[model samples]
Structures are given as structure tokens and as C-alpha cells.
Target: MPEAYWLYEDGIGEARATLIDDDRILAARIELPGRLRVGTVARARLTEFQLATLDTGEQVMLDRRPPGVTLGSAITVEVVREAIPEPGRAKRARGRMTDATPATGPNLLARITATGVPVRTLRAHEPDLLEQAGWSEVLDEALFGEIAFAGGALRMSPTPAMTLFDVDGDGPLDVLAERAAVAVAHAIRRHGIGGSIGVDFPSVTGKATRQAVAAAIDAHLALPFERTAVNGFGFMQIVRPRPRASLPELLRDDLAAASTRAALRQIERVPATAPNRHRLSGPVGACLDAHPDWLDELVRRTGRTPIFNA
Candidate 1:
């Protein structure tokens, strides 16, 4: 399948770059502000022996503070894990303070283009082919619980420990299980869902059919993940490495917060002469209105107060 990149700006300071393989979104990169991402090198003040929060408000948990470092002392740290945003809490990372700075690597977009994939920037008004191909709906479905396939539906729930997927429908047990397996794998990849995952597939009697379900998972999902075969109770466990927040965590944990942040990002990208207008949904508008400091910052940065329509 031919691969292409879709770079999107939602016109309120938020931008996302999605890599699509034919119709499926293989990966997505979202711009997050005020957080330290993996590979970021910066000087940080040690708040405690093993924890230091950066100037960007991202807290980093270190293996050990530098030998001579004391609380409130400045130390250089390299981010090993990006911050994962959680509800009503600050994003946190895992890193270490070291004396030497490591070489910085290419960013997400640069790395994608380095592989010779074609990239296309999408404006807010432009039509996205990937969205037309059901990828957008998939993202929405992921945010909610109902991810519908042709014959069945997958309900995904993320807990504090792991993500759970429950499959259901009226189709043949084996057929529905196979389809749900593929859908579960797709959801895992599309949402960047990582860590431990449990899938409750429809019960299939034959051992070969159960193995086939596991094979479907292997065929559709990406690598670097280990999964157990379907057991007698029709349950499978998968372990995947998580380096950042999943899409569901970003969008569903706090929809209003996410939309408000996106609006701020859009305002930053507005051209000086372009009227500086923004239209937001009712909830997002309320979120922005509740925070006068953000509006003040927007005005200060752009020199033009945006005309907001709710």
C-alpha cells in the first residue's frame, strides 16, 4: 500500500500529522505544548532526590539525582519518556539528569519524510482523504466505547492499569471473533494504546479457530508487542510499550480541555492580517471563556483579539 502523510491544522493552534498507509492511519503525531517530549534536553531544577520538574511543567522521575545535585540545584536532564497527560493532573516523564548532553534526533515529521514517504499539508478547510476513508470515524469511535466493524462491535475501556476490549455481535462465533481481533489490533495501533491490553473475544470452540484469531492479531497489528494466544475462556493478553499518551487519553479524559488547548494553538497560527476570527463549539467556547489568562495571552501574542463565535 502506498503511504502518505497528512499534516492538519485545525485553525486554533492545534496541529496533527498523520501517516496513512492507503486508507488506514499507521501513526499520528500531535503537537503538545508545555510538555517535555522524549529526547528533549534541558536544564532542570531538582525538586527532590529522584524527581525534578522542568520549566515546562513536566515532571520527570529520575533513576537517581546527579552525584553532587541537591534539592533546588540545577541539573541537566534528557527526557527518556514523553509525558502522558492524565485527568486533573500534570503530565509526567521518566528521565535522568546527566552531565553530558546527548545528540538530538530528527523529529517525528522529519523521520517520516526521511523514509521517502510523500507528505501533504492539510488546511482547516481542505478535505482529508483519510477522514473520508473512515479513519476519522475510527478516532471518534475510539474516544467513545463503540467501535463498529462490518458484523460486530468492539467496546474499548481504558483503566488505570490496562486497556480492555470486549467484542460482541450476532454473527458466527468464529467469524465475529476473527473480525473483532483485527478491529482490536487496528484500534491498538491507531490510538497508540500501549501497556497491557485484554481482549474478550467471542467464544470459539475449535482450537484451530482460536489460533486463527491470534494469527489475525499478528497480521494486523504492528511489531514490538507480545501477545498470548486465546485461552479457553476466549481472553487474550497483549503487552505493548507505551512511550506517550494515547489518543483516547488526550481526547476523552477532558474533551473541553483538549478543545480549548487546540483553540489556543490555532490562534497562534493565525496570520496577522487575516481578521483573527475563530468559531468554536459551545463547550469549548465556555472553556475558553472561563480562562481569561489564555485570552490575554492570545491577544498579547497576536496583537489582535480574536473574534470568537460560540
Candidate 2:
């Protein structure tokens, strides 16, 4: 197995943790300030049941309503998935009743340490390891959800029902399907995507070819996921443990927030001695001002207060 390590950067608006294997980013994680994270155990009241179905396509209306759980009752719960922001209405986060003690969930770095991976923390004064590894390229893939591979690319669309991938390219039919399957797997890891995922691959005839497509995903993606075989129509669905919002979800849901984080990252890269070291404008400046803590952190790292026209 190739040795893997995590390059962690504590940024202003977010803290990023990336898994590096063979000198490339194998996976990425981003955590925003004060968000209710996955694995967070806390006492909560049993609110109204959601009208939506679970990622597994199972009806959850009466499922979470087991023996002792009653509506409007106090119950200890653990967050399973964060709230999904749709066009107009947002989907409330999904949670399940838990018996564990109430405690704050692990942060990005904490989660990486829990996996026993060696980590090298990056300081602002130190060399830009993440940038050298194509951080902007990865974020672009997540923000746009168009990820290119050898023969083709996968267009990832995050819907309220599930995240969908459309594999479009030109190549040998069987080879394209197999390659798309692997590319989808890598995109899932690279973007920290989880929950219900669907991939529509090009039609393939032979059963072995279909199996090969599925095998490619199994070989590339790590375990802790359940998937259905490639069906007759060349569609496969995967369900993974979605404890929090994925990287794509974070970037696509809010343009201003994403811009704010990007602005902060840019400011961090400038030398403190520069005349315009901490300058921001437009939505990024306004968004940054709303979050005093993040702005304070930016100053703490760069040693300069921001100049903005918010």
C-alpha cells in the first residue's frame, strides 16, 4: 500500500484537511466555523418528521418512530447528514436517536488523527504545500462538478434526492464505462462526497463488462458503503455514511460564502509587508465582516487588518 499522509491547513473561514497518497490528493475535507458537524451527540427534541425519503430510498416517516420515540419529546440524537440547501427551500438535516453521551464531534484534524494517518500541519509562513498539489484545481472541480479523467469526465450534480453523475465522453464503449466508474469513485473521495450517489454510465452489453465497471468502483473507493450492481440500463447507485456536507455541497450551496473563503485564502498568501496585504471587496468583504471570528483569524495569521469596502 502506498503510504498516505494528511496536509492540514487552518484557514480563516475554514479548516482544510487533505489526504495525500503518492504525492497526489486522494481525499479532501473542509470544515466551517460553528457548523453542527456529523457525529455530534447532543440532546434534542424530536421535531416533526421530514416529508422526504432517506438516501436509501426507504420511507423514513414511520421508520424513526420506533417504540419509545414520540414526537415533541426530548431525545438524544446524533447528526447523520447536514442540511442540504436547494433552490428555494432547504432540506433539514437528518438525525437518529442515539444512546451515546452528548459531545461535540471531532473536527477535521481530529478526524484525520482518528484514522492513524501521519499529518503535517501547514503554517502560513511555511511553504504552500496544498497549492503545489493543485488545491485550486480540486476546488474548481468541486465548485463546478465537472471532473475530467483519461477518456472522459463526470458531471456531478447535487440534487435534493441525491448527488448524480453523468458520464459523457468518446471512447470504446466498455472502456469508457469502466473508466467513468473509476473516475466517479475518485471524485467522491477527492470532493469528500457521500450519501446517496447515482452514476449513469454508457450502455454496455456483456455481463463481464458490467461487472468490471462495478469492480472498478470497489477497487478505487474505500469500504463502508453499500451499492447495487450495475443494472440493465447501466446505472449504479451507492450509499455511503454521510455525516456532514461534502466539499461540493459546501461550495455550490452559497456563492458568497465560497467567495469569502477564496478571498481569505488569497489574502493569506500575500506577504505581510505588501502595501495591499489585506484588502477585500464586494460580497467577499461583506461576508467576511459578518464573521468577526474569521476576520480576526485572518489578521492573526497575516498580522494585518483587512481593508474592505463592505
Candidate 3:
């Protein structure tokens, strides 16, 4: 374990946070605009409830049903888990009924600062410390869920139930399984994935190999998680506290938003001394036009109005 600090960068429609350790990204988080963040205290209406499934519609689940805060009651709840959007639907944002003062939670920068860890803020004029650290490659992995390691690769799929890591590669599956286990742990931290996680090793892998693979995950990942032993099927499930959407879920659930923000980041990265006025086309351009404030921000940064193609 090396001394780790956070890198914070402001982008269009999002705040990016990366945990840098040993000159690479150890973990990362993306704070999308309009998200109901964790640790926020707000007044919410208790619309519905069930045994374990809550349908608050506000996408907030109270930590526990308060004694007097029944359905249809207006109450204050401190957010526990932010809303998570998956392929077809979204998960509720979870909160606990609270009597604390109502206030918006700390934003990404604030949250990172509260960690008592050193934070390096990247400004437009500052050298692109983030890009130099393979930020785009991490984003691509989040979008595609494909991670290639030296000996193997892991394909992570975030379903409504759990995020699945299917290990793939050639030759000596048991060896590959162990190697893939390491990669899986790396991907888990790098992509900020939590909640239920399933890792699938080659089925034919021996029992001893399965245990070894499980051990690999334990050795690589930090503690504070509960995991089931690798079964005969080579499947192991690990559960972590999921407070918000993982990097892949944020990028994959809605590609239009992802593309829009990515385009803005690209445009923002242009040299401050570059020529005035730029041309943007297709969906990216259209998405910008759809959000005038974002476009105005771009204009402010680049000092030129954009030319839209079509």
C-alpha cells in the first residue's frame, strides 16, 4: 500500500475524482450532474414501501422505517445510496430517515477534501495531469467493460442484480483463472464498482485452483467486504456497500450523456492559445446545442463560438 491521494478535475456536467497511487490510478469516481448524492440530507415524501423493496419513486430508501414516518408522510432523510441506473431501469437512491438539519451533501470535491487526503485540482491552464495518467483508457474500460491484463482479460457486465466478471483468455485455464482474478480485483477498484459482484472462472478449473483464485481476489482487494467461497462452478460472489453508480454503470447506462460529456471534455482540452472558433458535428454537436449553458461554458473556456455542422 503506497501513499494515495485524490486527483480532482472539473469537466462538463461532471466532477471527476481519481485515486492516484504509485503513479497510476488505484480507484476513480465520476460525479454526474443532477445526481442525488449520498450524505445529502433532504426532506422527502414517503410514497411507498414493501418488505425489502422500496418504491419511493424519489428513488430513496430509508435506512429503516421510522416509527412515525409511514407512507405518505413528509420526512427528512439522509441519503445512503444514490440512484443507480442500469440497462433497462434504475435502482432507488437509499436514505435513512433523519432529524438532522436539511442541507445538500458535499459535492465531489468537497467529499474528497473531507477525506483528509491531499487533493490535486486540475485546471484548464494546468498541464493535463489526468490525461497523462491514462484517463481516457480508464473511461474506455468503463464504457466497454473490457480490461486486458498481461495474461488475460476480464469482461465486466453490470446487470440489475450484480456486476459479473467473466474471465477470458487462452491456454492453461487454471493459470489464467488466477491471473484473471488479479485483473478482476484491479478492475473492481479502478471502476469504482461495488454492491454484488460475481467473478466467473473457467468451469473446468480444479477445486484447488478455485480456492487459489478466490485467494487472489482477497490478496488484491482491500478488506471490509464479505465474499462467498468459489464454488464448483468457479463462481464467487462478493458484496460491498454500493453508495452510488459505478464508473461503467454511469457511462454505459446512457451513452448519449456520456458522449456529450466526453465531447465537452475534448473541447475543453484544446490549448488555451489555439485558434478561435471550432467545428463540431453530428450527435456530439447536437447534444451540446441541446444544452445552451454547457455550450456557453464551452464558449467561455475556448473564447469562441462553436460552428455546428448541420
lDDT of 1 by residue, 1-310 (tens): 3455554433343446666767667665555554556677777789988998766665789867567777998777888777666656745688877676644434555655676777775553345454565555655665687888879889998776788999989868999999999989888877788888999998799899999999999999989999999999999999998877777776776778676876576566667778766888999888887877778877776777788877
Clashes (backbone N, CA, C under 3 Å), per candidate, total 4, 0, 1
Alpha carbon lDDT at 107, candidate 3:
90
lDDT score, candidate 3: 0.81
How do the predictions measure up, each by TM-score? Answer: 0.78, 0.86, 0.90
Q: What overall lDDT goes with each candidate model?
A: 0.75, 0.79, 0.81
**Consecutive 10-residue window with the lowest summed lDDT within model 2:** 54-63
Which structure is stronger by TM-score: 1 or 2? 2
Which parts of model 2 have CA positions greater than 4 angstroms off? 46-63, 66-73, 277-281, 308-310
Candidate 2 C-alpha lDDT tens digits along 194-301 = 789999999898899999999999999999899999988999999998767778888888888888888888777877677663446577767876888887887778
Between candidates 1 and 3, the one scoring higher on lDDT is 3
lDDT score, candidate 1, position 310:
72
Would you list the rank order by lDDT, best first? 3, 2, 1
Clashing pairs in 2: none
Rank list by TM-score: 3, 2, 1
> How much is the lDDT of residue 78 in candidate 3?
83
